[model samples]
Target chain A: SQKIEQNSEALNIQEGKTATLTCNYTNYSPAYLQWYRQDPGRGPVFLLLIRENEKEKRKERLKVTFDTTLKQSLFHITASQPADSATYLCAAMNNAGNMLTFGGGTRLMVKP
Target chain B: NAGVTQTPKFRILKIGQSMTLQCAQDMNHNYMYWYRQDPGMGLKLIYYSVGAGITDKGEVPNGYNVSRSTTEDFPLRLELAAPSQTSVYFCASSYSTGAKTQYFGPGTRLLVL
Candidate 1:
């Protein structure tokens, strides 16, 4: 069966630190991978997307790396702040890149 | 643009009852999708439409129905709501390209008793 996994445990870090999250998948070769940020009691918002041919993508202080050979992706938030605290989700295309399958998400808390 | 919007932010339904969860988007996107999220689980696709009048079943489509009559409106119908149907429902829209980013609505919290 196909599976996607994110860090199950919550991550805590002080402000101005770098926070890293991981996503791993099996049995699916996606054309692209996406990251999303979701706050409590709210819907997810798109963050970044990395294509299979791209090794890294960055926007401001956020960065994402996709390693197709290892079936893994890493999300990073540099100089994190309290406002950046939220659950981050990783999603990948399935069924030939038409549908999306998401991981459970990793909760991140940045303390002031 | 309001992006994607879903009506009835919350609903409580009795088992066997039927109701429709409404979703609309103003982005003029050609692709729309419906998903359900259970506690501590990832979002599960219920159904999706590439364009008006064209729909397809997704990973978990049982007990739910959806119709896309217009480009801006896609409503999910729950026939005989079951306890298993209790979950947070989200509506999303994206461009015609399958790899494009999706924008999601706030979602509807449904409780079946």
Candidate 2:
């Protein structure tokens, strides 16, 4: 079975700094990888998505890099703020797109 | 748009009891999915429907059932609930385009004893 791993340890950074989260998968060559933001007591909200063919994608202050070579992806939030604190999840979808398998997720905390 | 909406935000059920978690979306999307999230674990897809009558099982569909009778509604049913069924459930919908983004509901919290 395919396995996805994200840093289980929370990432803590000072406000206005860049916060980076890592997602690595094993034995899975996904068609597309996506990132989501989740808060306590709520479902995840889609943030950004990058295909295996694409190297990187950015939206506003958020950026995502897909390095299929290493089976890893990096999610970066620039100028992070307290409000940006949340759990970040990475999901990998295969060619059939039947379902998205999600990683455990990394919690990001921006301190002021 | 109302995005996705799930009813009965919280519920408590006894062993062998059954209940349905209602999910609806006003986006007229063609793809709907049900997922469960347990502590320390990310979301796990339970079931998904491509359209109104086409349903498929996901990784954790063993204890759950789903029906998509309309484009806007996808409900998840739990028959004879068990302790392992206790988890937060979310319903999401997306456009027909493969790999399109999904809109998710607030999720329903279930507790079984």
lDDT of 1 by residue, A51-111 (tens): 9999999999999999999999999999999999999999988856567888999999999
Q: Please give the DockQ score of every candidate, comma-separated.
A: 0.81, 0.82
TM-scores for all candidates: the values are 0.97, 0.96
What TM-score would candidate 2 get against the native?
Answer: 0.96
Quality of candidate 2 docking, DockQ: 0.82
Poorest 10 consecutive residues by lDDT, candidate 2 chain A: A92-101
Q: Give model 1 RMSD, 1 decimal.
A: 1.1
Interface RMSD of 1: 0.8
lDDT of 2 by residue, A2-100 (tens): 888999999999999999999999886988889999999998999999988999999999999999899999999999999999999998875577778
The residue ranges of model 1 lying beyond 4 angstroms of the native Cα positions read: none
- Candidate 2 structure lDDT: 0.92
